[model samples]
Target: MEHKPLDQLRSVADVQPRPLSREERLQRWIDLLETDPKRRLSSLGEIEYKPPAERALLREDDSPLTVAYEDPVLRADGLSSDRLGDAMRYFALSDGQAHYALCSCLSGRTMEAGTCAQRLRNATGNVAWESAVGAWLLAALAVSLPGLVYLLS
Candidate 1:
């Protein structure tokens, strides 16, 4: 008999998660600016922007969910050459919010309940979430220009 099942299991084991450094993280974000559906959806979601606590903050009411922004698009700029598209993409959800953010950009960030951290009234722009998102999209666009032409054209 063939060891096909064993081979499949071995393939799964061979797949590994790549570790991303801080610099790499920002670069990745900028790079993703051009394309990515999840990103696009998120940028659109920005129109419906709500307070951080009301929107994308982790909960403590036994839900154990980490409310964080999610970019679930291949090209998440919302649209090509659109200024608003270039604004930034975000989606606040819950649990395992393993997203790329920098200390300087995300500095002074706090967790809140009953509302979004963004709308906490005390929440301020110590963190550079918008900047971070901008950086990532720019990078992504630079590297994927040819593809962009093919897409938008």
Candidate 2:
């Protein structure tokens, strides 16, 4: 007689192992999320997360928290230190276009600030009334500027 492997000796499916129930499957998924440090929710409590390398790495000196604390650039847009982390996390989960917009905004490109912020807002679905109002105001000014100058001159 020759000794054979267990798999060859018997079909394990014949033993009828228990299939996972719906609740068990759900629990297992929850457990996996809870136990996985990388998958686990951060203080922001968002399910989607990015690894540190993927997130914007602002140095202490360049951090908006420190250098921009008093600057109104980010603050004026309601992105203070308190909400900055959440925005960065959002950017991490968003597309490259949003990330580029955020980078432009954070890197002090004032000319593109409003557009960049709008892009970020669009990505996060948190467009503010003030931003809309400002856009209208700017548009009105732009449309009226040439006529106003012509009238005055």
What tens digits encode model 2's per-residue C-alpha lDDT throughout 1-153?
Answer: 986766865664453335544334323322333333232111211112445444443323322223224344333433345333543442233445334433433344322223433443454443556688999999999999999999999
Question: Every model's Cα RMSD, please?
Answer: 18.0, 18.7
The candidate 1 region of ten consecutive residues with least summed lDDT is 60-69
Top candidate when judged by TM-score against the true structure: 2
Each model's total of backbone clashes: 42, 0
- Alpha-carbon shift of residue 132 in model 2 (angstroms): 20
lDDT, candidate 2, equals: 0.40
Q: Name the runs in model 1 displaced over 4 angstroms.
A: 1-9, 12-14, 34-51, 55-153
Instruction: Give each model's whole-structure lDDT.
Output: 0.32, 0.40
Given candidate 1, what's the lDDT at residue 57?
Answer: 32
Superposed on all Cα atoms, model 1 deviates from the true structure by an RMSD in Å of 18.0
**lDDT score at residue 62, model 2, on the 0-100 scale:** 27
